[model samples]
Target: MIFSVNSKVLEKVLSKVYPAVPTRTPMPILENFLFQIEEGKLTITATDMEITLRSAIFIDSTDNAEMVVPAKLLYDIVRSLGDTLIQFQIDIDNNKMQLSTDNGTYNIGYAASSDFPSIPNVNHDKKFSLSAKQLKKALDQTAFAVSKEAIRPAMMGLLFEFNIDGLRFVATDGHRLVRYSLLSEKSEIPEQYVVPERATSVLSKLL
Candidate 1:
């Protein structure tokens, strides 16, 4: 398969998802980015099993394909290329992928799409929107209070409580605790979810 995209644009998309790639992992596959191209859109995804990040951009491609490529190597290469058009050629037979720009061509080994873990589909039946400012403020107020101890996994995340009064963000280590409330449309049914600390950290940066 062959496709072309602007290096800077691809770099931006990769940056958005790179945080989810763990620095140290027992599973080597988690160190790579899952690249999926369908129709004319290219999607890049990375996950450390605990959290997943994905970003997409339109590109010039005549075929559909999926492969896993080394995340750090690819991102670093694209970032150094400056503004240029990059042509990608995937040699499935040899399990190799080549990236070519006006200045140079680079080759990196790739793995079959099946080797990458599948990303779970999230159910969006009930959803709400929060401005970046509001979300960032809430995270700033509560993230510090989350527990660092591994004994209790539940306290390592922030509690999201939705009720009649409003939505409350709560976090607690064994001693200190914080609760921040934001007034919004009241929900008839109260709900609670514990968002992992790693996920919250990455989300704050993105916002």
Candidate 2:
């Protein structure tokens, strides 16, 4: 299928998802972004198995198709194009995709979408909807006290506990245990969840 999309909009959405793509991965396809075209919308997704980033942009297209293209290569091609409309065509038989811009044309190889693992469908019925600022305050207060030691898995992360009175975050590394709490009128936490320090850092920045 062939389609045309605004290069600037594509780049902006890709930038948000690129942070989740890892430099090294067991499956080469994990380092790539999955592109799905349906009707007049283009869906781009990137993942490292644990975290998935997805965004949809409207484009001009005739048919629907999907492919897995290297994220880095796609980013480089889009960056090279200078504020011009880009025409993208995919040839499934040859496993090749072509990108055309005002300056020039480029072709790259891509893996079939079937080879890539399916993205997980997580069901979050009881989610806390907090503003970025409020979440930032909660994370900032406890992140500093999170354990740096990886020897013990449980001690290497921050603990999130919600109760009838409030929500609490705890972290320790054998030396010091720091706890931060915030009262909430609308919380019904059954149990506590432990989130890794690295994951906490990423979540903090993204929020």
Candidate 3:
């Protein structure tokens, strides 16, 4: 398969999804990004078994392909490249990815795409949208308060409480607690859930 994309554009997109990659794990497959091209768009996904993040970039492709490439290596290489177009050639049978730019060409080996973990499809019975600025502010204010202790399931992560009054986020590590609340003009949910610390870290980057 062959495709060409701008170096700077791709690098910027890669950084956004890099947080979801597992830096250390027994499953080596989680260290790579699942690269897929379909319907004329290229998508890269990273997952640490708990949270999965996907980002996309427009590309020039004649054939659709999917593969798994070393996340750190790929990100490091592309991030240093200049604002120029880079052509990518993947040899699925041999398990390799070849990148060619105006200045030079680079070749890297990759793992079997089939070995990448399957990303789950979530169906939330309820849904709500929050602005990006608000999300960033909320996570930043309360993330530090999340409990590090794992003994208590409730204290292990951030607690989100929703009610007619408003929405609230609570986090505690047994010694201290933090609460951040947001007002909702329309009341739709009265729910509570503990978002894992790892997931909150990723969400913070996304915002």
Candidate 4:
């Protein structure tokens, strides 16, 4: 695999999804990010089996390939570099990568591409798109009140409620509670979803 991309833009995207990557996982492969290159676009993904985030960036490449590179090391290297083009050269046979730029060169050890976890395919038949501004507002307002009790799965997450009137985002920690409501154009389908606390946190940063 070979590609050239902007370090600053790549770092921004990785930082957004890195929080969802668990520091300690039962499977060593889970500690890496799956990088898939196709045509001139590069797709990067990070997940902890629950919340998965994928971001894409345009790059210059003639070959397409996929591999799992150490997440923390990749993030650190990009963040430490200046705003210059980063040249990535991958040795698939040995599962190693070399990054070079004006600043310096770095090498990272990676795992077999087949060992990475497959991203779940979500059937969007029941999916609905909500405004990012409104969703971020609601998440910021109510995230603090999510209960820490693991036994109460329902309370461990933020309750997203909607009705004919409007929508409400509510959360509580048994002692304190918070609710953020607002008017919306999408109307009249009464439904609710319990968004896990960890997912909510990532959503807040991503939005």
- How many clashes would you count in candidate 3? 0
TM-score of each: 0.96, 0.87, 0.93, 0.91
What C-alpha lDDT values do all the predictions have? 0.92, 0.83, 0.86, 0.86
Task: List all candidate RMSDs to the true structure.
Answer: 1.2, 2.2, 1.6, 1.8
- What candidate 2 gets wrong by more than 4 Å, as runs, is 189-191
Give the alpha carbon lDDT tens digit for every residue of 1-46 in model 2: 7888888988988887787788898888899989888988888898
Off by over 4 Å in 1: none
Give per-residue lDDT, candidate 4, residue 2. 74
Residues 55-170, candidate 3: write the lDDT tens digits: 99878775788889999999999988879999998888898889999889999998877899888788887886778888778889998988777687778788888778877888
lDDT of 4 at 54: 88
Clashes of each: 0, 0, 0, 0
Q: What is the lDDT of residue 172 in candidate 3?
A: 91
For candidate 4, list the clashing residue pairs, or say none: none
- Model 2 residue 165 CA deviation (Å) reads 1.9
Top of the candidates by lDDT: 1
Q: Assess candidate 1 and give its TM-score to the true structure.
A: 0.96
Model 3, position 39: C-alpha lDDT score:
74
